[model samples]
Target: MTDVDLTADPLHDSPALREFFGDSYDRVARFAVMLADQGVLRGLIGPREVPRLWERHILNSAAVVPFLGEGTIVDIGSGAGLPGMVVAAMLPERSVVLVEPMERRTQWLFESAKECGIDNVTVVRGRAEEVDEVVEADVITARAVASIDKLVKWSAPLLSPSGEMVLLKGRSAGDELERGKYVLRKHGLVGSVHEAPTLEGLEATTVVRLQRQG
Candidate 1:
């Protein structure tokens, strides 16, 4: 994993973030700043584990915003609501659900969403595999959740027939894709991987898009 610069200013002002992301940009930036200022994220995962507010967390999360359609999104294992909360803050038109199994983390997610003033988000306290019946989402996202194979199994049922699964992964994404080929084929899913440039200049990050095969 690339070491994010904690001291440097990663998230810019509301106007700048808004200009970059449009209307909801300010809310997203505010949320990131609030997380840092309130020490919610740091308290949950320590200061060392928290990513840079703007670069690693906000922008990294926003990179996938373009791929999501104007439908519901379900984020599995939304620890600290990384991309889930960020996505909700950025795109209020779409409904965002953060699925977390841990009670403490779920509580933190709701608190963060409220503090961020994001009304489009909902917190579901349950594991991905157990709550598929209730969550029929157009897009399923998982960041640092599980391996590709396992994540596919967990997210499959929640996805709409035309839905896609987007997984945030690091350098070993290709390896994971290769390892998951058999499973993907068995599940009638085909995957295409896209690499997003990281601010840290370390290993490139990948956003894997998996769609159901006909």
Candidate 2:
């Protein structure tokens, strides 16, 4: 799989996404290539994910960029750098920290950033709940990491007073929000769901935005 051909895969590339990424296109492309080549071998992504890496993962990750604010970001459970690395690549000026508990995954993040020439990111090896070094992030993001309640609980302490969470979710986002209402109130936060459309053909991503209530 070392010589993986991205063009051969279904839905591997998109011009809209290229323009969407703009100046950061090359870095994001290289990162995708790396993921296609080594993601499964490293146990970061499954073999089935390679073909749909562009549409399902990379493009899906890009959906959160518009909703992000200025300053530092913390991505919880950045397994294979889906949204974290993608965010870093798209927003070179904003600082992104990829927080993962697994040792191998951390190493993979380090390598991916280094090899892709993305210097604005920091790879931190720890769970989001226990990692005290990263604090006051302007925005925190998590993709397929946990339930809505757990995501809020883990992200609460790391967010700045006015910070918010922009989580990537599936069709069950609404349900998750309903289920996490207690936690949202407990944390003095409110939740809303937004539809973030990517390319013309693909399905829009469901984004759950959680912010502290005034």
Candidate 2 C-alpha lDDT tens digits along 33-111? 9998888789988888877788889999999999997779889999999799999999999999899999999999999
Worst 10 residues of 1 by lDDT: 1-10
Q: Model 1: how far is 116 from its true place, Å?
A: 1.3
After superposition, the stretches of candidate 1 with alpha carbons farther than 4 Å from their true spots are 1-11, 14-18, 39-42, 49-51, 197-205
Give the clashing pairs for model 2: none
Total clashing residue pairs per candidate?
Answer: 0, 0
Name the candidate that leads on lDDT: 2
